[model samples]
Target chain A: MKNALFVLHNSADTRSSEFATLAAIATSIGNAGYSSDLLILDTTGSSSVNVKHGSAFRNVTAVAPDKAVGDGADYLVHIVGKAASAAVSLVVGFGTISNRNWAPQVAASFSAEFVTACELIEVADNALRVTGPVMGAMVQKTLSLGDRNAVVLYSGENLAAPEGTDIVVEVSREPAEQGAVRFVASEALPDSGGIPLRGASKVISGGLGIGSGEKWRLIEEFAAKVNAAVGASRAAVEMGWVPSSRQVGFSGQKVSPDVYVAVGISGAVHHLAGIGGAKKIVAINKDPEASIFKIADVGIVGDYEQIVAAAMRKL
Target chain B: MDIVVLIKKVPDPNLPEQFVSISDAQDEVVLHASSQYSINLYDLNAVEAAIGLKESAGATVTVVTADDASADQYLRRALAMGADNAIRVELDDKSRRDSFKTAQALVSALKQKSIPSLVIAGRQSSDEDAGYVPYLVAHGLGIPALAPIVSIKSASERTINVGKLADASIDEYELTLPAMLLVSNEINKPRTPGLKGVMAAKKATIEVVASEPGGVAGVPSKYSPKKGQRAIEATKFIEGSDEDKAAALLAALDK
Candidate 1:
């Protein structure tokens, strides 16, 4: 049977882990007729492994280096190198910062084929099919890997965490090579005060039409009224009305909120890509022809300030 | 010292959805006549970072890309924006689309001269969005790759400090010389060329290199949307006065 290895690198300080998505991916691999296993790279050097394992993975293992390996590319490469084996037919990872820094290097280590932004993977009659949206999520591209080893990177916002057994085999190893990069420190995102955007139950976003940085407070006011996280279109971010962390678009944070509200947003394809996972979208725009209305469950064409003002009063 | 920045020309991401569609027979994206092409926005940030580094470290900046002759205009734009030199690796459309082949071709071209002191590219091109080429090149040349950095905090001949954006924090790192760095948009605001720079770019000569036969790693056997993917249908606009619209929107949330 073909074997697939799903790997997640965890840090104690990190709030949201891609464990759920990795588990979900492993299930997809299993459905495609491949035996899947889970490997967690614990940067915290914790001896205990706490992951809700599902039937998707046949085995789960947690690895930590004996020495403090700073979150650098060299150490990540070293860790993945230690865990990856020749017998694994597929190596899977999430497209996060730490993984992106080293996953390709591991692919190079084994001379395996590498693909990124992988949205779906399935096998039919021995052909490995991998599909992902490219061109700002405007089009989808599918690739077939025929009996060749592959390393694939997937975005995790689309899938839920797997549920089942709780078992992990913990192991430790030594870093044999000296590192080339040194970790200095991590600082909080500037001016990113308020509810976090990702995983928010509700989101309210503003765009260039918000007028200016001062008026951006309206978005916050409305969001507070509805208890929604504040989000911004790329134009708003570029205009410096909000921090990049608050931006929602192809290059910004991807949010999968239960409800996403767009006020004064023109609905660029890139902005729409970030909110694709939202369960319900409500668009408030002055222009009736705004693209946001197309995908929105409910759209109101008028001055956003008036509508938001009315909604705030009612709330 | 030499700093190399990789750039790509892609269909303008701002193009309306009506202008873009999938051609099933061709197994690729097709842009209508009204669509436009520009430098991948993220790569523009990379170019800006490279120029800033060149100005600070007194290094020569070289912009490199693997594409056909049509990409020359974008290369000229880079030079106008402040790159010292530009090189284009002549690869066909098929080869250019394949990340492995593109990396191989770039590796071949980069080797013709001495290895650069630093290699930089956008985290990913807006088109392919693979983000695999730079890392592949780094691996091929046996250098470490660090990416999505927001700022180059400090720099010296042998080492450099960079700031990377994490979930809600900024992670800083010091990388040794001869590393690969993929820049994010937060790095710097890209500059527009003035008349002087534009005229100079028009007069500047671009170095063109023929692509070497880089063996294929693995090509996709098929390219298409998922079989059962659903297209998002247009929704009906909620009708009524401002007060009624607000009520309807809030009511819809209740359901």
Candidate 2:
């Protein structure tokens, strides 16, 4: 049976390694007949997880991770841990773009850390709930691998220390992953700038002022016409169109794409940190005078839907 | 209830200045300031939380460190903030990277004092960022532990509420008493020792027993921000009423 090792990275914000996430993933893999083991790499090796809840943390032993060369487990699912590169076992987050750029680089990291779970539980098929775009993509990728597949479940922001050709999940699937497919990226992908912003052209973006979640489609539609990637302002994200990882500016990704389109995005100083380097900016807003116009190379003064429609026609 | 606040001093990893000369010469980064952020913040929060509990329900606060005479100012500061007393456990600074040795020393010292009802500390000292000591301390004490706790409340004398972060959500668990906790920014804003408390602390003479120095040093490479002209402006926002004005402003911003 293939085995999986889950590592919990220590975060100042988290209480215990979200054992529930581990337990759920463990159950899924176990039902598939692969044994899984959980490893809690206490970055702060001193803290405890209250493993049994209000109980002692005697559960953790000095069981060092198996050496990389000897790692025979099929998949290693690292939830939380910090490693600098894809060569390292999976940390809970994504590594640099260089790692995610290739599936094999990320897959190898997980292969290095796979360990079978000692106390495995049977999980119902219902537990394989797909989360953000990356997670959905990862789950789909792993399922496609069938039995004996090693997998790593990480957040969009966390760096990945993959083990091997193990399945890696991300909301925004890269066009290069030979086997993976994008199921919900056009939707969930924008929640995060799953792909690099600097490499993008004809960029599509939104802001908090977009109002409701339903309004997010406006930016998406504009993007669809221009064949552009979607981007968002902090204000738009605060409204919940996207996740924190997708936020652009000082708080989010730093991108320098060509032909940046800001739809209903008021130019907030905080949003400029990442977008400051964009080559060309186009602003569209119903308000004849939104802050986004200040940075626009081309400003359209009218209803965004009308301008966007007119632009799409030209494309 | 007896509460112990575990604090540590290590090389400030963020400050690039100290790392430069040390890296080239000694090949290791050294601890600079004694009143480091992690330890100080954790220590004060632990002390304050303990004091609040004591005043509210009567828990005793004890501040201990694996530091030496050099930590006088910081220890004094902790005391001034109303830590009942302080203890110093020394260690030989050999690898300086092996804080486990320093933790061993402190744990040994604490075992002699009483198994505290609550143990709290910063997630990790800023210098080492090797957030291991608290867990080891908990392991040594043979009790449940929680790290990176943001909010805390006494569920009972032997139980406390801990707010911890998880990948998807925050986990709020009621921890059994006499457990260890790693304090984070979420736990509570640490209180600064006020001027009045400083005066009173001056009158306090802490007993210092010799052991060894904390044995955790590191190689901190200096980080000089690639030097450039620094701008003093805060944040800028685009504001306009008409499309022309807004467009003009946007053009200016792109520049």
Candidate 3:
């Protein structure tokens, strides 16, 4: 039977939804005629694995249980490479920072084909079918990894994994090759809380059409009422109304929230590309012909201030 | 210490989607007459980072690219932005799309000269956006790599300090010489070239290098648009009093 290995790193930056999404993909691969396993690398040196066993893998394994090997991407690549060399057909990882740092290197080690930002994966007729965005999200290209081992980075979220029997599996390890990189420190930004953007169930974003930095608070308040993450268009970010971290577009974060509310956003192609995976889009723009309305499931044409104020009072 | 920055010239990202069309060969997307080319956005950040390093630590900043001769104008622009020198590795449009092959080509070009102590690149180019080339190039050079960095905390001759914004925190790292850093847009505001800088760049000569041919090539088996129906025909517009419309929106969310 053809086998695939899903790689996960239990790091502070690794999102929980990534675990679930990979599990979902694993389940899908299983149904598509491939056996799947999970390799969780604990870079943070945590004693207990926080990820649940509900992931749809036949067996899950965690590497470097006793100590942290987190500082260098090379070490993670070494451990992942060791596990990946055991006749695995596919190596999958999330599009998180650590994964992005090392996953492609692992692919390069074996001269494997590396696919980034994968939105679709299927196995049929002995060919591995993969789809991902290219050219600044203008086009989606599908490729056949025919008779070649492949490494893939998945960016989608919250796929359902049917119930399955899962068990723990142990793998052999070796000391990481010494590298010159060292971890210095990590400091959390001052609380700007609602929810993190990547996996939030709902997102409320504002753009230049929102007017000024003062009025940007409306988007934040509305998001708080819905317990949603706050996002911004590149225009809003460029205007100094929102932090670059909160910017959503081709150059910023790619979000797949369940419901996305675009307030005063004119729907630039780059901004729309970031939210293409959102299940439903609601646009609020004063301009009746705003491009945002073209892809929105629901739209309200009026002054955003009045509409947001009304929504606030109702809430 | 010498610092090398990798840059790419990409089709204008702000152009409307209607201008984008699948090539006649169906292997890639091509833009129409209105398309213009500019240096990839994040690479500008990379250039700014290299220039910052050059200013602070007294290092020469060299910008390198892997594209055909059309990229020379963009390379001159990088020169205007304070890059001390520029190099172009010749690769056909088809070879440039294969991340592994493109990286191999870069590796060959870099090996032609004295390898720089540091290399900086954009997190991803605006076009293709595969984001694998830098890491692959790092792998080929057998060096450590860090990416999507938000800021540089400190720099010295032997090592440099950098930070990347995580979900909520900024993760910092210190790396010794012979490392790669992929910059994010938050790193620094790129400076506009002055008239003198532009004049100098116009007269500057760019070095052209030949790429060695041997690495795995990655071409998509098929290429197409992700969505067929971009514009929803029957978008439900909530119409009523402001409060009533708000109520309708809330109800829609409940679905």
Return whichever of 1 and 2 wins on DockQ: 1
B1-255 in candidate 2: lDDT tens per residue? 787877665433223333222333432433344423334444566666666666777767777877666666676777777777877665555533444556567777887777888887875453433345665566567665554455665446767765553222334555666777776543554567889888987787766656543433222222211111113232233344444434442343342
Chain A TM-score compared with the true chain A, each model in order: 0.79, 0.41, 0.78
C-alpha lDDT score of every prediction, in listed order: 0.77, 0.46, 0.79
Write candidate 1's Cα lDDT for B15-125 as tens digits: 876787767684667789878988888888998999998888888999998998888998999899999999998999877777788889999999998888899999888
| Candidate numbers, best TM-score first, in rank order | 3, 1, 2
- Candidate with the larger lDDT of 2 and 3: 3
Return the DockQ of model 3. 0.59
DockQ top scorer: 3
The residue pairs found clashing in candidate 3 are none
In terms of lDDT, the best-performing candidate is 3
- Regions of candidate 1 where Cα sits further than 4 Å from its true position: A9-21, A31-33, A43-47, A64-75, A156-164, A168-178, A220-227, A237-254, A309-315, B21-24, B225-255
A1-315, model 2: which lDDT tens digit per residue? 444444443323233224444544444544544444444333232324333221111122212222220110111112121222333222222211111112222233332211111111233352221222111011011111322222233322111222222221122111221111111111123323233343454567777556678877766765664556677775665455654334465434545666676777776544543565567676667676676666666666555554544444544
Estimate the overall C-alpha local distance difference test score of candidate 1. 0.77
